[model samples]
Target: MEISQRHEGARGTISPSGSLVAHSSNSKLRPATLLSHSSIRTAAKEVSTLKWSSDSANIAIVSNKLVEVQAVEGHAHPTRIENGSGSLGRFVGADFVGRHHLLTSWEFGRAKIWDLSTGKGTDLGDLKTTCDEPAWQQRPESTGDIRTVALLTRLAAEDTLTMHFPELSTSMQPLKLPTVDAKSMSWSPDGRWLAVLDTATASPSVYFYTPDAHQYRSYPSAANLEGDGCLGVKAINWSADSRVVALSRYDGTVVLLNTITFTPLAVIKHTTTVEQSNLPPHQQTPIWREAVSASNERSYALASQPVSPPLSRTKPTIEPVELGVAEASFSSNGSYLATRDERMLSTVWIWNVATLAAHAVVMQHSNVRKAQWHPTRASLVILDCGEGIAYLYDVATSSAPLAVNAPLPGSPTLSWVHTAAESKLAILAAARSSFWILYPEGAESVSDDARAGVEVGGELFEEGASEDSLLDILSGRKPALPYEIEESYTKMVELEMGEADEGADVAFDDTFREKKKADTDAVDPLDDSQIF
Candidate 1:
């Protein structure tokens, strides 16, 4: 079935040799649709990414050499990006910032925005090549894609840049806070607030921006968030309902804030040990220091004084959320949050959005590929837990989740498509030569058996001495993870890897000797004219 208006009619694939071929299928067992490369263009250029216009009338195939936007109807010549431009660099990705503007990221780490209406492109002006915040201005009513652009340049005490449309009009305004070298700043998804994080100071320096009120509030000023999140905020997520925001920190602490009141709703501290390094426990400093010291621009007397131990190092404990390779996804209903982390064990934590409490912890063996809630079923969640295994975690009932193992397990790549109409959720997992979708219900898998088995939050991988619950046992002895305790050091590890080739070890001592002898006998005509 056609997924949407833009993806209607047929499904397509781009070959490694850079060819787009269409395939048609009404169901999983249907025959494929095919087209010849000779009918299209048969050149062998590597395609880095492909993007569709919001309207789905055009598809852009991006590569190091060019960006070609092809019409869906396969009519006329594709709009080639390099047709007239001479300074275009090798691009690895493309962002359709607006319908009329295309932002291309270069291999050199720079970016340029091109205006489709005028055929003119403007370099984002030598901004940090790594800044990921080049975004189009967002307004619910503004849909035609002629939106303005906000370009973040140097994070070290920088200005907020706005480049107007058509004329490419420009404006610059310094950040409302005195965060010298902002380090990183992000606008909430709804574009209602901007959160600026500064790592320049010895402690965490965070600020929030409210555009309508033209107000900037520091972390300490926000009630309840005072003295919170010491290891620094790593990422920020805005709930779709636009009521609350979640700030996750390096220490695995999560703080929630209310938009309307600018107040902290909850502070979810991890089951981690707080170890003080440089200063003794008595000389500690609150992570959320006020306008004190050189942390924030507003001058305070503490900057010149010695460390005064913080009033308290205590935190309120909740269920321990593991630290992973940094991944979290909010449910479509905005009522749940799923998080995966890397630790001695791998787990998926689903939390109730309103209470910020763990509703379930899905323990498994494989790294979680993805966890997304069903579009229509608030209690249903689909999980892609590597090795062709899928699970339907129904929180509505406290039973082991339904399990379905597919035939494909060799794939190392998988991603979720948007939740579709009715109750369907599409999965686009990479197979051998191409990628395909698994059924919304996930691989003809029936619900797991009701009999008791080794289970972790209702997930069963295996049970044996090799799989002892060491961390679970250690956590159980602590009563609660957030109790105040003196800082202590645990462990440190340094890893080094050397690059070696299998064929590099072939005997070359005799070859090197012969080459040296040949060089000694060779004449140097250029040496005679040297130093002129």
Candidate 2:
């Protein structure tokens, strides 16, 4: 009510208040619309999950008690699926099978498929396992085509997997599995194989199978990746083609395996080091400490403070901590793989999937919250830097970072828009707010596939850009110096801007200062290599 009122009293009356920031003109993304889910109200729902359909026309919102399908273009769903008996044993997971069906699982060994088109529901037999990590195979390319979906649930009788045709209400051949607690699983891009990582203990045992559950190959324990050989698996992701499987441990060691033969392709150990860059005010980067103990609450469940030390933890370390891969993702084309060096603001590694070697080590950001490949482009990538900013990096083009002031309302989810004739991206801030980013053509920057990769950042070092050069480029990794140096540097930048009458844009002024620093600073040229 106050936002629409003309009566002036205080800050609420100001339409363009100082707190309500206006976006910069240098950016190409224009706000299109904001969609709010304020109508969603129910005590039974616990943090609803939102997923878009292949055509980007509908969204499947799954909550603790019900799975609701909402058409994105404001089309009403004429029929609703009957969710049998509310609160079905704690909703474990859910996903869209094809374009018209939503597959959901429950913890009490129950799995159900709901056909959105017909509003018909099918109940599969008891899964006999803790239902979690339910993933669907690649959807059919043709719209409205039935999708083949697989569910990996360990039954009390035996560890077995079930396949189903939600469209026809029929079950495929049930395949038996060897291990329980399948920590992670994913489908190959072609929908032929299912890769399952079963880490019941510290031993990282993995299995690959056809959709029918026929085991193709059993992989050696990535427990070997651990010093004690006891830590369980942290994360696993399949390449775009499903030919390669990337598995990571908590200690920042990434191991890639060939999906066909289940053989280790490459093992990259990510350890931080200092490097040489003469950009003034060189300071030593603090060592990344490993997580010694986990709190009773999950990391995501804990409330976040508005301000805290960038890389400081108060708990004293009695024993040495080990770092592991926090998150890992494959590019859309499976040409590149990126891993988050757990808990470290510096040290995000990119690898060439074809060569199975480290392609580039980017020690540039304070923290990389998330990384995902462009939907169509293989070399292009977008990174969410925990803060309100997002960066675009094109390893195929340059090694500079393009910063965008994208202030997401909550947890950031950046996805490419799949609508035809619209090369844009969408940002979903929590479940309430939505924003569309349109990089207009010929507007200095456009989201075109052919001319896309250019104008991106991260110094374009050769294929094997060594660790030293990357560390040198990262401001946080210089040599450890007193805190006053950082403070003085900040003061210097502020003073320079003031001397110039604050007439220039802040970004441009900072860029000019960095340019001047680069010209005056003496440093050895960066050396690159052909590790591939």
Candidate 3:
């Protein structure tokens, strides 16, 4: 199947296989057109993973059988790489080492490095790692240098974490961890800390360490003391600033940690009290009311509702009830966080970072397959719900989200592509037969009216802005201008209708003299004319 894009008057139409038509407009924040590269094709039946290069100029799509690298620009044909002899494992994950080379890991702990220019693969031998996947360092931008890669190898008695520096052709000595079975490991965006989650102990624990493998702290997961089985951790994600990390547990709880202090900031539990209670009084039955009352102890209910019993009175009675596996992610600017629970797969909870409270909640009709914030846009979020249409949520704008229709078959996955020209969203179909690229026509700037409360003393104060502003300003680095500061100073002043009188003039003269003396003492240097 092939996808085609055509323009008709002010609207653009996308026709795939001559059966589906998606219309787009330029005046609103909608996808304008679709672009599909014809030269790239997958040999396997489905795509297991899709990853963009560090430079964002190419995308690597790995299938269960093979790997294909396609250039984002031009009409260049895709380069295909296959596994070497005696390696009988399927590809699990892949990462770009630099701009020119690719690292692909497979089952049974086998890996290889492929040269894109020559399409040749070099075996790295068996890694014998406890986890099938390797954790690669994430870079904000392409740095034209080899990135540091890490692998967790399991020994006979203990587990070891090793760092590999491809540029220097050297590997760090294996750092033995306290746990015997390490499930997975990840590195922070700033590359200052490493996190390892192990499940071998009686209760799962997450360990934090420095770059050199010095263990500083460890936090154990809260036990299901109410007799519910422990589900353990499902995933780990780091914030853009590297100051906070989110751990998504299988028991429908999300734990936020402060990397600097190594302490738990908050624990979010998934509950249906708020959602079910919002319905009309007729819909709330006796059974629903009982459930709501039982959930009052653990749910993060809205603040406007009547406060529940204090923690001191309800601490021992509360139980970490099992809902389902949960997923959480932070926005680009770290101002908002989004989460979804498997039990309520159609609902998404958005939390404000400054207040650590719920900002907005969204509910969809189908199961939400993926929800991600735009790479550059702070307020805009893209979501796919196993349907033909994609939803855009602008939390700062309207109460309801906007939709864009692209009728692709099977479940769809979404990823944002950051190119030099513009930012595009990639929608990969489940069949692996075709994929569509969407160009957002226009994006509305978040209004300053919503942030009027935080605008103080001609400077906008935000949760994550203060830490970097002083350092950047002192080092002569220019900071991006805020939307609130774009208005002119003259427009902010108000004038009274009546004219001034002699009495007002006399008061102004005295006030002006007092201000002048204060300014001189504050700005002028110490001199002989000044009194001690």
Q: Write the per-residue lDDT of candidate 3 for residues 214-246, one digit (tens) a residue.
A: 887776634332224565666788888888888
Better of 1 and 3 by lDDT: 3
Q: For model 1, give the RMSD to the true fold.
A: 23.8
TM-score of each: 0.59, 0.60, 0.59
lDDT by candidate, in order shown: 0.47, 0.49, 0.54
Please tell me which predicted candidate would have the highest TM-score against the true structure.
Answer: 2
lDDT of 1 by residue, 204-283 (tens): 35677654324467664634443543446566666666677776666556777787765678876533232345666455
**Once superposed on the true structure, which residue ranges of model 3 sit more than 4 Å away at CA?**
1-52, 57-84, 87-92, 114-125, 128-146, 200-204, 221-231, 275-323, 406-411, 414-431, 438-532
Model 2 lDDT, residue 184, Cα: 55
Q: TM-score of predicted model 2?
A: 0.60
Write the number of the candidate with greater lDDT, choosing between 2 and 3.
Answer: 3
lDDT score, candidate 1, position 106: 59
Task: Tell me the lDDT of model 1 at 194.
Answer: 63
Off by over 4 Å in 2: 1-47, 63-65, 71-77, 84-94, 116-119, 128-132, 135-146, 200-204, 221-228, 274-323, 407-532
lDDT for model 2: 0.49
